[model samples]
Target chain A: MSDPILRLEGVHKSFGPAHIIRGVDLEVRRGERHAVIGPNGAGKSTLFHLCSGEFAPSSGRILLDGQEIGGMKPAEVNCRGLARSFQITNIFPGISVFENLRLAVMRKHGLQFTFWRRVSRLDNVTQEVEGLIERLRLGHRAHTLASQLSYSEQRSLEIGMTLASDPKVILLDEPMAGMSQEETEYTVGLIREIAEDRTLLIVEHDMSVVFSLADRISVLVYGEMIATGTPKEIRENPQVKEAYLGEEVAA
Target chain B: MKLRPFLILLAVMVLLAIPWLVSSSMLNAAIQMLIAALFAMAFSLLCGQAGMLSFGHAAYFGLGAFATVHAMNAFNGEGLLPTPLLPLAGAAVGLVSGVVAGYFSTKRTGVYFAMITLALAELLHALAPHLKGTFGGEAGISSFRMPAWGFGFGTAIEVYYLTLFWVLLAIGLLYLLMLTPLGRLALGLRENQRRLRFLGYNVHALGTLIFAISAMFSGLAGALQSLNIEAANYAELETHVSTVVLLNSFIGGVRVFLGPAIGAALMTFFGHVTSDVTRVWLLYQGIIFVLVMMFLPRGIVGELVERFSGKRPAGEGIRLSEMLPRLAGIAVAALGGVVLIELLQRVMSRDYRALAAGGQWPEITMMGLSWQPGSPLTWLVPLSALALGLALVLGVNRRAAARREATA
Candidate 1:
């Protein structure tokens, strides 16, 4: 199918009196890095939540590989080959970094509800978790509890878990929120490498990372997508310059 | 690591030899301890591993007991459910009830999840008496242990072996289950239920399965109770049954595989020994619970493991010289507190009040000594002990901190 890997058509969400996502529309093609950028309260996170099934859209359709996924349960959305990371670090804090990825990878291996086999003895899963830890540069901290990891390491774990499922589309919600400059740079390179194979939908506040990493950028303003274009096209877009990118990109 | 399995085997052998070493009455108490240990292990699966604090596990345990009793009476313990396999009846009933209750309870999580379990158990307790045929009414159901597999199961020794056999097998299964994928997912459920959803896991379904499995083992424990006593009582469904298992599991350190079992066995043995002498056994149990939560939040076995886990630097280990004084202080404080509680209990008793009507405070004999209740010495002695204990503990803490700083 030639359709975009993830398509959001005229999506709208409202909480009683609050219209958080007001008729937003976007598309993420397969094998490309897509970034969604907007000021605070522009409904960027809400849009991620909508696509991720944290909240059902009040209206409109979300299609993954031309299959309707809007309003589906998170597990159902995930099984359809879409996985996401939270803006706030969401991980199994009580367990080791290796176990967290194993939990993520085990589902793909059809190990859900398996009671007879020991998880430690599942050689493929252990290997996959080890490979993920190495790729995230967290092999040294593999057995440490997720809660004990430094903030940046925890973020890497979150991304590592999201990627473990080998999903067709991956959504990362401001993964670099609390990361240091060096950490962010390392993560930018990491994300770019991972995005080489899978479709990525990321919402990042760091302007330089977004501009440099995204193959296509969607500028959201006031619950609406004002512009969607390549990096060079978005850079020169006058309307985008006025609404969200103001002054920072101009300099 | 190699010593671990050898130790377990040696412990099992010791348990196997208990019938020869202990009196029948002691063996009988050991039977109760085994049953209680099994119950607590079942509970820890849901509470410690899955992180669902169920306030009404007695519902499953009691259901299992009643089911086993009915099975015994129906088959005369000779057919499908022989003396050896009777717990299967309890297991089946427990699993069914667990699935039904877990479906509703797991729909809401945390405090709400706990409330649903409590409500369901309370509902069963309320309705149990009305269901005369099933629950055997107020008097409950009684059954006789029929001979099966050539063992009469007629004496306390026989019953103890029976209970030991089943408890070991059930506990063994539980340990194996913890090593499985489902077992690891239960930890994930406790760690972060929301994250499991995005990881392509049906969190609610997983919770229900775990809850049912826990209830299944609990039912087996109840079955053992019926086999030991040759009866089932509605009294098994009481809230105290639920609370005791919760307390015992927490005390044993639910996170450890055998922690709850050890906690339950230890507490049951203590209860059997002290219930006759002190009416305040439960109060002591409550106090121990509170103290464990405050001072050793990991519970008895949990705290022990943490201390010996070698996670800290070798130099950080408490020296015997430093620990001796602290241990002595704690023992003194405990003895003093027990004496005080016993004295206060006797003083406040209606019998004591009647014995000493109007201005006459009688001397109460305890611990091979007579103490006058109205005397200053009585209050002063225990209070002094408590103060000294507290001071010693605080001093140790301050000293440890200072030593650490000096070393740094």
Candidate 2:
């Protein structure tokens, strides 16, 4: 690749005794949809956490567009054009869907601590929030409380919140965890629509979804990268079959 | 734009008319209510909205009051920035103190946060008396008049109007704050601090900002109180005062916007009535508190509004037929326990007055019941009554269980 937008070099992390993310090194070019897939407890989520600045690496470095972001706070990382949707739905629950999106827009517009002016009356913010709501097909539910939305609707709102920041890179953690087949298809469409301009790094458990959406796949086992290849190459790898795909297929 | 401002205007007009319709003593009482209302609202911002239960709110109130008093003295009983603007001094001092304390306190959450605030307040209480130069020691500082501001002549009625204006302004501003993004985030922080952190918002900064705003309003109240009463002392900063404000907010329904204001008004009214009618006013307050906690946890205004909004089921008001029996049972149990404990306490003392004062070898006699110090029979009635009360409670529980099972 000409110049990767994100690069992780020998990232390490541990939770007291249990070592997770032993040494994760990966790179993502601009507008590339990279997928990280592994069995449960294989540190796939932990790697995302480290990449997004939710967890500080025990050692090594994380670089965003050639600038090191290792040990930076989540807010600082967010300001640098990297944003992530949580594994669990983590949008503001009490606020209306409109307000939730407005907050993200406000942050992007550098209005986090402006207290004198009323936020609801800001025409620019309201316009942006309304536009995002229309694009996400949440215009009907704009006034509804975020908590009152259906499971799939909330997942879509989560992605919408991440998009509101106008990020260069989007990190999605299992965007279709609890969705029905229809909901999953709808979300995959939304993901594809979003991936047109943004660099995407997703951690997913569903192999079929991974194969369909990912341009490149990195397989992890026991906190280490076991293989990196195209979906067809990964499906055909004998070692990967014995280690992960075999058990998944047998189940 | 239309409804919120109209409501605010209506509230302001009603408050402005209070002094003209009531006696001076009543106006005095109203002023106290306004101050208490402001204090309770500040408490709610931290406790109800932010899920931070502070046991040291009086520290801000007292600090503001003291600062106002000192400012008044410094200005030599003249309005330094007009009497209407005097509250800002208190608010400024409060903001400084709140920020200083909030820096360390926000590092911990939940019970540890409560404990830290409590300890900090207690430390201030201890320091207030020793800082005689500024705090005026146990005597406290007193104010006279502020040279009548732009309204001319310093009268109680004028002071009342000034207080009413400030109260309405402060409450209205707080209401506006609740609709802001920062305010919404504060509520979200209460629900899940970790989620907020992941969303790339500084949870600590949000908390500190809320704390500072709460303190600023509290200080405004304290300043108004000092101007009205013409005195600020150590009593204002005591733990008991903080608890009183907290209780009032909780009793009024912390989550409701106007709940704390109504609660403060009711409490002030209760204080006036009880103080006039009986020496043991605290006992009456305690009894009312227990009753409110057991039956109306949402607070007086909260429950009334909830009912009016049709949130409660139809026909949910207290039914005389259903309530009377429960009331009778509770009355009997409470009386029995009180009598039994009193008897036991007297029996351990020798003097009747001493027992009433707190059992220094006292004796007891009331309504043909008497007990001598060190008598074994003195222990008998208390132990028996306690056992009987436990049995009655258990019997009630069993009855409830049986009813539930039958329905099931």
Candidate 3:
């Protein structure tokens, strides 16, 4: 197989006295939907933070496309084509939905610091943002404030914003944290559609969605990955069953 | 957006015609008003647009004034740079100081950012006089505006026109800036800075740039102030100047594009009126500020814009018929307030005491009437007015609350 799109080599993270990620060696291959599933307090979010450059790993290397990106700032990491969404809805609430997406699209087109031109007159940026709005079904809310959007709609917008950068690797943190069954199914389908030709690293608690979507699953237990395998192999893995999936499978 | 340029043109026309119609004194006041308005707008860009509340904006304003004065003095001797272009010196100095100050200040956010700016301003204010050579001690630097562009700026009217030209151009450029990517990003920075970072924006650097841009305009205002007064003083850098700019911006409505202009004009005119007529002008100014804060928190223009905004959901609006009664009530209340305040001032005044000492009963003159202090009518009339004012204000407020609840 070609080199993995993202590789975490013995990554460890600690906050003062508490060690969160312990020797996390993981590889997310190109064009693969990789899901990290773990119980609460298993440092799943911490691991994502390490990968996304929100916090520097205590020790170890994080390589993105064969480049060391561990200690870089979030903006630098984002500029290198690694985009992420927050577990909490993170968007410019005062700005219109189109503006929120436009900034991202503009950044993708290397217009982050383009101040000479009026943003309203940027036809290409506008066209790209409108396309994104259409794709996310947010055309109706193009001019609405992001704060005024419904929770599910905001989640969808967040996903759309993540894609606006046209990132090589997309990391989604709890894409469906609080959603109805129908909303979840809708988002899962949306995620499937977007993740078609890109590398995806998702951290989700929904077992069914994870099993159905992930080409490979890494089961994290107490800041350590105990098992990583395909859905069938993971289902048959005794350690993952004992550590986490035991109750879900039995149920 | 299409109407914006037309409105700007209209504003320019009105401003240009003012000196022709108004008295020379009023023209002088207008020039100061324009300068203050520009300063306030520069501040609004930081506090209102960028979400950075700076308490020491006068630092840039004062520095600009000094720079302009020095430039005028130095260039006047050389006969190279025109008097009209002296403000560019102020802008340059302002930009340089903004970079120096912003570098240190932008390291922190929120209140810390405010404190750092305040400290920086205070430091300059204290140290400037001691510098002597640069600050000219307490007296400050002074320079004459040289004749330039074949137009001698000898009269107040000419200076007014010069000021009007610079102010309009600055305001126009600033407005255009808001439509630019940098300005839009400043809004985003205010809304969700962390989100911008995730979008690959260096938020702090952008903030510094905004700070510098705001400072440049502020400097221009200061430079104009120096030209108008023919002197730059320590008073320009004082906390009082900062407070004035803050008040003008807030009273006008920081969020609205022209709010600061309206505010600066109102405040400058008010200052002129109070200084001419009343000894207790500051008290009145304080009362006006409090009233504005309590009732018109968004500033005059802000409230008007909100009331008439097309973006407001349909079917909700104020009919003049409904508003006329409120206006009438407010006018009555305002009259009552003025009478009560005037009466109270007369009663407590040192002038009233001097009159009493001279064996004459203290009298108050108001609205074409004079009343002896001992007369029950004097007390009763004002007391009644005060009561009516309170009643009308309460009634209006209750009606407004009811309307809001109904809408909700």
Measured with C-alpha atoms, the lDDT of residue A116 in candidate 2 is 70
Local accuracy of candidate 3 as per-residue lDDT tens digits, A172-246: 999998889998998998899889989999999888999999999998999899988899899999888899889
Where's the lowest-lDDT run of ten residues in candidate 2 chain B? B341-350
Q: Can you give the lDDT of residue B81 in candidate 1?
A: 73
CA shift of A250, model 3, Å:
2.9
Q: Tens digits of per-residue lDDT for model 3 on B1-408?
A: 788779878878898899888988888888988998899999999888888889999899999999888888784454326888888989999999998898889888899999999999999998997899999996777778788889888999889988888988998888888888888887887888888888888888888999999999999999999889888998889999889999999999998889988898899989987788876788888888998999999999899899877767655577665467677767777677777677778877887788778888856776689877788887777677667766765787687778878888
Model 1 chain B scores worst on lDDT over the 10 consecutive residues at: B75-84
Per-residue accuracy of model 1 over B140-214 as CA lDDT, tens digit each: 998988888898879888888888989999999999998999999999999999999999999999999999999
Kindly report which residue stretches of model 1 are placed more than 4 angstroms away from their true locations once superposed: B76-80
Best by DockQ: 1
Chain B TM per candidate, please? 0.97, 0.79, 0.93
Instruction: Write model 2 residue lDDT over A1-251, tens digit each, in one string.
Output: 54889998998898999888888788888888999988899998888888888888999999999999988888888889999988899888877898778767877776655567777787888899999999888989998889989988898898898888888999999988988898888788888988998899998887789999999888899998888888888888888898888867545
Put down candidate 2 lDDT per residue, B157-223, tens digits, no spaces: 8888888878878888888887777776677667667656656678788888888888888888899
By lDDT, the best candidate is: 1
> Which 10 consecutive positions of candidate 2 chain A have the poorest summed lDDT?
A109-118
Alpha carbon lDDT of residue A83, candidate 1?
95
